[model samples]
Target: MITSEKIKIYAHYYGDSDMWARRAKSSEKAILSNDWYLIGSLIQEIELVNKGLASEKFTLNLKKHLIESCDNQETIRQLESLLAMNK
Candidate 1:
């Protein structure tokens, strides 16, 4: 749904449902396999791909959602620690 009103699911390539589905599955697989680097790269792509105001806001909220999704305190702390250390 690439339009002026609706923010695209993904900003790269084709922003369609199928691509979004693949991204979700791939991210899930990466998580299941402890492929942190791959998932990190994927997330980084979100930030990189979004350039518009709406897209930027969506990506920001997406990042917030990801952080909020972590229920474990230690995991959250580790994520925060890693983010803090990021150059």
Candidate 2:
């Protein structure tokens, strides 16, 4: 489980379009570091934002990152459901 502070950090870091490339790079680093918990928090934040206002780019980026980093079937299912809900 990820702490709320970490979740906020992940959201603030990744939510900046000006920093997107850097964010993606950092996400790749997190993936390589095997930080699934942080990844999960990112996904959770994305889901929260998606529920309020959909951003196809952010959704797609998050989905791609989730697919790449997450191995848990349940998490993937939740991602799918979230995607479906936003669509």
Candidate 3:
């Protein structure tokens, strides 16, 4: 089970984006089933569709969650390393 703290953090990362939050919040159960790949896909969709649009703070918070919830060390490292290339 995903911790409540993580969920809260994710929700904060989502902020006031109702559509994105709704989609992600609805899929919360499926996301915790060790299906990190699907979660990654969902994240990518959110990033692409909402890219260059979210506030800097929200984007950074979202990126933090992505790094924290990534399936493995490599994925976490990869995402964190990309912070420097934020567009």
Candidate 4:
């Protein structure tokens, strides 16, 4: 599940209600499609970008979640590659 913390990160990154609303709609679509992994990854990436080391482990875990949740082989491969690089 995509958390409020993640949504907050999206909201913060976008920096406007309209943009945030659009993101929220997209997030809802992702959720409905069971593609929450993408949203989770995106949020974690934003958190890492904004907070750096404070979010390193959190981002890594989110990447793991992406690995577990992703159905697309290419996406899983890319995420695995990223996780390996991060390690």
Best by lDDT: 2
Those runs of model 2 whose alpha carbons end farther than 4 Å from true positions after fitting are 1-40, 78-87
Work out the TM-score per prediction: 0.29, 0.37, 0.34, 0.31
**lDDT accuracy of residue 68 in candidate 4:** 60
Candidate 2 lDDT by residue in tens digits, 1-87: 333333344344443434533555665445333343455466565766657665777777776766665555565554444333323
Error of 2 at 68 (Å): 0.6
Prediction 2 TM-score vs. true: 0.37
> Model 4 over residues 2-38: C-alpha lDDT tens digits?
4444433433434333544465666544443343345
**Local distance difference test, candidate 1:** 0.40
Candidate whose TM-score is highest: 2
> What is the TM-score (0 to 1) of candidate 1?
0.29
Clashing pairs in 3: none
Instruction: Compose the digit string of candidate 3's lDDT tens values, residues 1-87.
Output: 224433343444443244345565655535443543334454563465365767778777766665566655555544333333333
lDDT score for candidate 3 against the true structure? 0.47
Q: After superposing candidate 3 on the true structure, give the runs of residues whose Cα lies further than 4 Å from its correct spot.
A: 1-50, 71-73, 76-87
lDDT on C-alpha atoms for all candidate structures: 0.40, 0.50, 0.47, 0.48
